[model samples]
Target: VIGVKRRVHGGLRFTIPVSPFDRIRALKQECDRLVAQAPPDLPVLFEQVLRFERMIAASGVDSVPSHADGLASNILIGPDGRIELVDFDGAGNVDPYYEIGILINEVFEDEKDFLPALEMFEGTPRPASLRRARLYAIADDLAWGLWGLVMDATSQRKDVEFYRYGFWRFIRCRAALERVDFGSYARML
Candidate 1:
């Protein structure tokens, strides 16, 4: 078949649909932004983002409808355990692992919990997918970190510490990027 389409839930809002390439390009643009307190390894981080973009292009994975910003703040769990999703501003079709990666990164603070949680999501753990998820998480951090910096620089709101939040994300991204197995993960992809 030349193409395939899957019907998504009616409630899902993909009004701002975007391709993974769009996301990558946006990240690249964000990297060009000047931040006085930017991470010391900004150059390396930029390089990694480009490398992952290439890997993703070569993967030939089909994009699926996803609430691209699957951060914890957008999720709500009722007392009966019914899960509800909100904030579709960034909803779009993206690599399935991007969605999974966001969830794994947000829900599991400890790296040790990532694999088991991934297993629960996939019904069986696939190391390669995990690597992809981890890489996606790093990309997420860089994207949001840059976003925070922009917001901090421009927003008049004093209620939020946008700069601090952005720097924190940069720190997280740096840590994950520096992991000893990070190279192996990239190679596996």
Candidate 2:
């Protein structure tokens, strides 16, 4: 057999220099734009947004360097089983729980897996953090659902099912919010 050599590429830095406050403001603006463009009948979306805003305002957790967007499409797994992340345009110092929340929301479909997934991330899961992550997931879904709506209206690419994507996100968000545990999450915070 001929000798073969393999090389693994080093992990790519998925961050660009950005001020945390500036990034926060930009995120808010983007969310606002999406909300404005979205149809107005979404009470659940509005409630989630308000709670999220309050949560951010009152959060005791310090911001840390992390990926601001956790869409699975931004992550890549190499044939060699190496993982890399892309899309640093939104990278900045943000609440680490928010980062983990986005990742957990994207990675897990069953709500039952949320606490266990948190354990995977934190080594030992903390209930408060789990609650925070859940809240963030709700907000993330709402924001992305609105984004889908806005994109459907503005995007010239009619081939893409933007409305369907948004509707699904909204359904997920609303379902999560309407669950019995949702209030428990809010009260725990």
TM-score of every model versus the real structure: 0.83, 0.76
Segments of candidate 1 deviating more than 4 angstroms: 1-21, 27-36, 180-183
**Top-TM-score structure, candidate number:** 1
lDDT of 2 by residue, 1-189 (tens): 000000011123334433333433444455566545554657546655566656655656655566666788987778996777778677765666777777788888987888887786667988888888877787787777767777776789999998889889888888887763645655666
Regions of candidate 2 where Cα sits further than 4 Å from its true position: 1-40, 180-183
Q: Can you write out model 1's per-residue Cα lDDT over 30-88, one digit (the tens) per residue? A: 64564556667767777776677777667667666776665788877789976667787
Q: Which prediction has the highest lDDT against the true structure?
A: 1
Deviation from native of the Cα of residue 137 in model 1, angstroms: 0.5
Cα lDDT listed for each candidate: 0.71, 0.66
